[model samples]
Target: MSGERRRVMILAYFYPPLAGGGVHRVLSFTRHLPAHGWDCTVVCAGPDDSWIRDPSLLDRVPAGTEVLRVGGGSGLALLQRLRGARTSATRSSTTIGWLRRAVDWFAFPDSYAGWAARARAVAARRLARGDISVLLSSSPPDSSHLAARSLARRFGLPWVADFRDPWVGLHFRTPPTPWHRARHRAAERAVVAEAAVVLAASHTHERELQALRGRDGRPLARSVVWLPNGYEPANAAASADAESPPRSRDGGAPTASTESRFLLVFTGTLALMDSTFTALEALARFVRARPAARSQLQMVLAGPYESSYAQRVAALGLADLVRLTGSLAHDQARALQRKADVLLLWKPLGVGYRTMVPGKLYEYLDAGRPILALLPSDDEAARMVLDAGGTVVPPGDAAAVERALEAAFGSWLQGGRVPERRPAWLTGHARERLAAELAGTLETIVKGRR
Candidate 1:
C-alpha cells in the first residue's frame, strides 16, 4: 500500500522502563506505527533513574523502533535517588509532598525543568540529519513540550503536542500565587498557539484546549485532537518469557481458593486515590456489619502505594483485608487484573477533575473484569465504566461505596461471576485501532507540510 515509511521523532519523558498510564499509550503507538508505514524514533528518560521500572516493557518495543535515552535534571527523580533503596515506598515517601511544594515555588514549567535544555540539545542533532519530517511530544512533566516547542522554532519543523493532562488546569493543587498562575497560563497558551496540532487524551481536555486563544485573540492551534488512551491486549502474550495469564500453582485458571474469596484488585500508581481513605471506612464497616465477611473479602493493590495508604488501612483496622503488592511488571499487572473478581478505580471530584482520566480505565475495560469505580457521575471516566457494564458510585458517598462493596461481595459469595461484558464498540479501544487513528492524523500533518 506504500513505497517507503515516513520517519517522525517522538519526545516522551515517561516512556518504557518508567511504568505508568502514559507510558503504555506512547508504547502502543511505537509498536503499532511501524505497521502503518511510519518509523518511530523515541527520546525518553534513561532507566537508571530511581523511578518505578518495568523492564518487561522494553521487550514489547518493536525491534525496528529506535529509543534514545538521555539523562539530566534535578527533579523528583533526583530527590528519589537520595532516599536509597526504599523504591517500593517511592510513592508514599516524603518525596511526593516535597515535589508538589517545589512545583509552586521554583520548577517553573515543571520539576524536570533542568532536563529541557539537555533534551533539546540531543533532539537538535537528530533533527539536523534531515531524515525526520515531523515531531511529536507527549507530556506530564510538561518539559517535553517545552523542549519540542524550542526545537520546532529552531528547526522550523511542524510539531504535534500531546497532553496526557492539562498544564494550567492540572488537578490537585493548593492554589498558586497570582504570578505563578499567570506564568502557567502564558506557557500553556504559547504551546497551544505554536503546536502544529494538539492531541488531548480526554474529551473535556480537547474542549478546554480548543478554547485557548492566541495573543492575537484567535484559536490557539491549527486543530485540537481528542485521542483518548487505549489498551494493548497482545503485548503480554507476544513474548515467550512474558508473564502468563493469571493462573494458580497448577497452571490453570485462578485457583479454586482465589475463586472462593471475593478478590478486588487495583493496579497502578495510587498517588491520586483521593477518596480511598473514606472508602477504607466503608470496607471497615462492611467487615463490622458482617464479621464473617471479613474472612471472605480481600483487596489487593498491585502497584506502588503511598505509605499513607498503609497507615490509613492500619488505622481503619483493614490491614488484614487490604494487601499491597508494591509494584509489578507491566505484563504481570495485566495478568493480575485477569484474576480479579472486581477491579477498583477511584477519582475524587475537584476542579478540572472531569478533564483528567487515568490511563488504567481503558486497561480495566480490556481486562474484562467488573470495575468498581468511585467517581463523579458526570465525569467521562464514569461514563466509560457504565458503558462497559461496570459499576460506578459517587466519591465520598460512604453509603453508596458500601453498597457497591456489599453487592459485589454478595455476588461472589453466591458462586457467581459478574459478567465480563465486552461491548461491540470496545474493540475501538484496542491499541492497534487507536494507532490507526494516530497514523491517519500524522499522515495528514505530514502531507500538509509538502
Candidate 2:
C-alpha cells in the first residue's frame, strides 16, 4: 500500500439494485472517483428494496470498487422488524401498520434507523484502519448521515455529509407528524453540525439550511456548499443513436418537413407528486375546447401511476384520449423522448416543492425537446427550465397549460423549426469535476482534525 491513493468509506443506504435518483448520483460519484485520486469503499443497503430495481445502472460502478453490503430491510421488512411481528400478514394488518408508524414516530429521525447497528459496527471497523482518509455519507434514508456522525464521534475520523435531498425540508412527500417533523429537523441539525462539511445538491437547499440554527446557537454557514446535479456527457454520448431519423410516434415517413402532431410526454414514475393525472385533465379540457385540434395534439404518459390514479383517468372520461404505457425500460424511454414534440414536467403544489429540482430535469435538458413546465412561479424546477430556454406555466392552471400546449402545437403544425438538443451540460468529466470539489472538502476536514 506504498504511495497509494487515499481511501473514502461511502455510507449510502440507497445504492444500486435499489434504483432511484439518489442511487444514480452516488453510483456515478463512486464509479468515477478513482480518477480524482481517491479509492472508494461503499457501504450501502442490500437488494431487498423492491420499489425500483434496475440492474443496468449497476454497470456504472467501477470494475474493482470495493462494495460492503448490509441487510437493510425493505419498507415492509423494517415495519415488521420494528413491530416484532413474525409474519408478513401480521405486519401488514391495519392495526400493526398504525402501531409501527407510532413507534417510528418516537424513535430515530429516519428509516435508516433500521440499518444503524450494522452500519455503525462496520463503519467503526473500517475507519479504524488508519488508511481511511475521509468518511463520506449521502442520505435519502437519511440514516447514512447519522451513521457517519456515530463513526466520527467514536473513531475521530473526519466526515462529510452529502445531502442529495434535505432531510426535513422540501421532501417530495408530506411530513409524518408534528413530532416526527420536529425530530427530523432537530436530528438533521445535529448531523450537519457534526460534519466537517455539508454538501447540498442544489442552491435552494443550501438556503434552507442557512435558515435553521444549530443546538449551540451557531447559525450553519460557510461549511455548506452547493453542488448542482448535471447531465453526464460521456454517458449520453456513449448511448447516442446516430442513424435514427426524427420520426413521428405513429410511424410515418421521416419528416424533415416540420409539420407533425403535437405530442406532449411525461417520462418517469407517475406518483402522487407528479402531475400526470392533472396534465391529463388539462389535455381533456384542451380537446373539449378545440375540436379541430384533436388530430393535431395528444399526450403520451410513459410511467407507472398508481392503479387508483389510472382509474381516476378512466372515470374522468379520458380513457381513449390519454395513452398510459406502464413503466418503459430506460432505453425505450429515451427513444420516446427523441420522438417527442414537447417535454412536459409538473411541479407539485406547496412550499415543500418550492426548493426541489428533480433529477429528471437534467435528463430533460439533454433531451433538447421543448419543455412545457407546470410549476410554481418561484419553484426551482420552473427556474431551471426558464434558464435552459424552455416554457413555464403556473401550477393547477389547466386552462393556461392548455393554451401553452396549443401554441407549441401551432408552431410545429405551421412549419416552425424544431428545437435542437442542448449541448451536454452533464458530462463524465463533470463527475470528475464534482469529485475533485468534494475531495478538497474532505482534505480540509481531515487537516483540521489533525
Candidate 3:
C-alpha cells in the first residue's frame, strides 16, 4: 500500500541469530530479495524464546528489513499440559528426553504445535492489509506452513511453501505406527496442496515433495523448485579482529597462526541421534593405534551437548582427548572453521541421519578445510565430501576410522591436502539464484490466478 515493491510475508520459525539449518535459508533470501522485485516482512518467533538464535547473523540483512517476532503461543501451550506430569527417580533425565522424543515422533503436527496459534495471528494481521502479494512459509516446524495455509484461505492470498527440509520424506524419522505416519503425511499433503508454489532446498527434497503431492492425488502443478542452501561468500571472506575474544571457537584468536595441537572441530547441537559417540570412539581407537595422533590431536566438540551424554563421554575416559568447547556465536563458529585443519562431520546410523544433508557441509566447504566426514555408509554428507574432493570415514566403524586417520596423518606428513578444486555447484550466489527461481514460480502462480 505504501510503496512500489510487492510485499511478501516470510513465515519462518527460524530467523537471524537463530543459527540453525533454517536460519541461513530464510535470512539470506529476505536479506537479498529487494533487488529481485520483492519486499519481505519476516514473521518468526522471538529469538529469546527459541532454543538457538544468532542476532549477529541479522547484520547481513538490508538496513530496513522488517522482522516481526510473534509469541510461541497456544501451539507451544504443552508446557502447561506436561507441567504436572509425573517426576520420578526411575525416570532419569535421559529417559525423560527419550520420552519427549517418543512423544514428538508420535505427535502429528505437534512438533511445531506451539508456534501455530501465534504464527496464524501474525499472518492474519499482516495479510489483512490486503497488500501482501504472497504468503511464504518455511517448514520443519511445518507448523508455519499450516499457519500460512490457514492464512491463504482466510485472505485469498497466493501461498509459497518453502521446504528447507521436506515434511514427509526419507529424512523424517516418523512414528513406527501406521496411524501416526498417516496423520503426519496427511498434514504434509494439506500444506502442499494449499501452497501456490512449493520449494525444496535440494533436488532430493523436490522429488520427494513431488511424490508426496502425487500420492495425495493433487494436481501436478509446475510450482515446485529445488533451491539448494548456500553460504554468504562475502561474509564468509570477511575477517574478524584479533582483539575481540573469538566468540565461537575455543576462546582464542580466530586467525591464530599456530596450529592447535590435535584440534578437530564440530559445530551444531550434539543430538542423541548424532554420531559424536562413535566419532569419539574412533578418535580414541586412532590414538590407541598411533600414539603420535593422540599427542597431536585435540578433538574439539562445539555446540550444546546433552549433559547426560557429556557424562557418558567422561565415562569413556576421553576427558583429556576431547575438549568440550561450549556453544559459540555463529560468526565465531565460522572463524573456528577457518582455523581448523580437519572439520568434523558426524551423522547417526539410523533413521533421519542417512537421507539428510547437513547444512554445515556448505559452511565447511566455505571454510576451505579438509573435512573428516564420519557419516553413515552412502550418506549425503559423504557424497558432498567426496564431491568436494575431501575425505570420508564410515560412521561407527572404529577400525575404518583408524585406517582413515592413519592415511590422513601419513598424507599430511607427506603434504597430502584436500584438493583446491571448488565444486562448481557450491557457491553463495544460491540464495539470489533461488530467489529468482521462486520469483518465477510466483509468476506462474500469479498467471494461473488470472
Candidate ranking under TM-score, highest first, comes to 1, 3, 2
lDDT of model 1 at residue 64?
Answer: 86
Tens digits of per-residue lDDT for model 3, 1-450: 123567688888778656666688887778767776677888887655444455667777777677888765333334423654321111234644665565556445755565767778877887777777888888777778888888889888899888877663224564566777777777777777767778877666677667653645775444677677767652644445412333322344432222636357787766554567777777777777677666666666766555565665688777776765555667767776766667888754565545467777788887777788877546666888988777787667777766776776676656644444457777644567766766666656666786
| Residue-level error in angstroms, candidate 1, position 78 | 1.5
Better TM-score candidate (2, 3): 3
Across residues 1-450, which tens digit of lDDT does each residue of candidate 2 receive?
224577888998878766656676788778767776678899887775434555566766797788888875545456656656532101123544454466465446555576866877877776766688888898776777888888888877778888877773325444567766676666777877778778888789988877667557777643888776655542444344222433332335533322356667777665454465567777888778878877665566765444555666687777655555554445555666666788888745666666667777777777778888888767777877887778888777778887888788778878754866574444532556777776666666666766
Supply the global lDDT for candidate 3: 0.67
Q: What are the per-residue Cα lDDT tens digits for candidate 1 across 1-450?
A: 246788779998877777777788899889998888889999888775545677777878898888888875347667666664344424644657776787667777777777777778888988888888789999877888989999999998889999988883334454468777777777887888889899999999999888877668888778998988877763435343234433331234532244567888888877757677767888888889999988787777777777788888888888777876665677777777876899998864577677888888887887789999888888888998898888988888788988998888887777677766666776787889888888888888877888
- Which of the predicted structures, 1 or 3, would earn the higher lDDT when compared with the native? 1
Q: Name the TM-score of candidate 3.
A: 0.86
Q: RMSD for all candidates, in order, please.
A: 3.4, 5.7, 4.6
Could you give the candidate ranking by lDDT, starting with the highest?
1, 2, 3
Candidate 1 lDDT trough over 10 residues, lowest sum = 247-256
Q: Supply every candidate's count of residue pairs whose N, Cα or C atoms clash at under 3 angstroms.
A: 2, 4, 11
Estimated TM-score per prediction?
Answer: 0.92, 0.83, 0.86
Show the lowest summed lDDT stretch of 10 residues, model 3.
84-93
In terms of lDDT, the best-performing candidate is: 1
